[model samples]
Target: MERSTPISRRPKAVALTFDDGPDQIWTPRILDVLADYRIHATFMCVGKAVQRNPQMLRRIKDEGHIIGNHTWDHPNLTQLPLSDVQTQVLRTTEEIDRVAGVKTRLFRPPYGDLNDDIVRKVTSLDHEILLWDIDSWDWKGLTGPQVAKNILGHVRDGSIVLQHCAGPTETVKGTLEALPYIIEVLSESGFTFSTIPQLLHLSAYR
Candidate 1:
């Protein structure tokens, strides 16, 4: 039985976002699934991950996926001093620029953890925070079916789904397994997949 929204004729859009990636293993596998589906997504990458896999970051850019700064070490920004927060964002944005020549303006905090100070710091760096409306809970180590159930149960027009490219081994596997089901069910229900920028109609790279 279908788990997504009831079929509608009107056009609707949702975003698929993967975080903490540009890794060798999980990232590529997730990219493969996206490529097979021919859908562009957003990758919110950790700074060190980009440095460790510069070429992977470039490939992600080349493949028409949007990239965002996810911080240097995936710290909770709300817990950091403003100086540290600024450094975290700047370091990652610079790394993305160094690798891909794309000035990404998207930022997503680790664990959806943020506060007013963090928000101000991010915007002061010329980035807009992008959060998800639906979370797959892949990072929590749910199975494929569980991840799929989490997303499909709540996705609707203009939903942004939080997923991950690199996490625990089981997490990535779960996300990978859930992709086909998520994509198919959404498509069947007339929900068009989009990168966050496209879904929000914002300039992706500055």
Candidate 2:
């Protein structure tokens, strides 16, 4: 379906979303960080990764984070045949449902790449495209300070900030390092961290 508009928007809040995860290594540690701050962020999980670590996905849900699908293999949706694109999404959705016991309508295209046809196909599966407003670029091996600057420099009320905990060690190291500082700074500014559902007032799972 079409992506959601605000049912009611929360003020002075930001949504922290992690993509391509349910990672066995960094995810648990990242979750620990979120727990320490009593924050609930969103995790956009890939199917094969989840298969390797279903328990991690379960942990994500058990701890109250909303889980969204990031496709089976993180393919660019606009480049695939529409049927293949649908399969990529459905397969991941099914895996998430099996592991987490929830069906999420939230779907984020890999690399934020999508076209009208891709959207039509994904919407056919009842998924609402969930893209981010802020990209930390942590995947490119930006330093912790750089990652913090990327987010803090652009953050605003109701912004969706993207970071990843699942990737090469070097790629995620900066993100893990920057997370606490970013969270603390944002919190001190009276900005609350929200999961996507909370920010947008949409159902997290169905």
Candidate 3:
């Protein structure tokens, strides 16, 4: 299946987003890397994680990074009932608003799982569905160099690069290690990193 590129007016811009996180150890590390590069990215945080790490979410927002809902438990929305899908998305939305004091304007279904009904349900809740064009695949136990290669090899203008900060130790390790290299290489190539809302020209918070 062909994936659609995210909408962007600037040809040299790319939106970097992380999923399933706000993890105690990895999230902060990723934040540190972003801080070092002085770049901003989006984080699609799971509700349970947000509840567990409200301070991390606060830091993400405080640092000018956008946060999106990745659902409460990271379920495949396409297979779930519509009501269950609503619960998953809305619960996360509420949790984010509760912690960050801002309603999320973006949603990325777990595993990129979505269908017409799921889309409708999410939109009904006023979220723009977000997906990525470039996947780092850092969760596949790839080394940091390999993950960096995967991202840089596929990245293009207006790409949304998907990565994760939560998972097994190796997954987090590869992602963290590859981040600085990704930022440096892409910046040298004249690409500016952006948050999803910034790239899409949508509201980051409601």
Most accurate candidate by lDDT: 2
Task: Sort the predicted structures by lDDT, highest score first.
Answer: 2, 3, 1
- Candidate 3 clashing pairs, residues 3+ apart or interchain: none
Residue 61, model 3, lDDT: 93
**lDDT, each prediction:** 0.86, 0.88, 0.88
Q: For candidate 3, lDDT tens digit of each residue in 100-161?
A: 99898888888787778788889999989888888888878899999999999988778898
Give me the runs in candidate 2 sitting further than 4 Å from their true place. Answer: 1-9
Summarize candidate 2's per-residue lDDT along 1-206 as a digit string, tens digits.
21223324467999999988978899999999999999999999999999999999999999999999999998877888988998999999999998889998998998888788998888888988888778998989999999999999988779888899799998899999999999999999999988898888777777
Runs with alpha carbons beyond 4 Å of true place in candidate 1: 1-11
lDDT at residue 174 of model 2 (Cα atoms): 94
What digit string (tens of lDDT, one per residue) describes model 1 on residues 128-183?
A: 88877778878889999999999999877787788899867988899999998899
- Model 1 TM-score relative to the real fold: 0.93
- TM-score-wise, the better of 2 and 3 is 3
lDDT (C-alpha) at residue 12 in model 2: 90
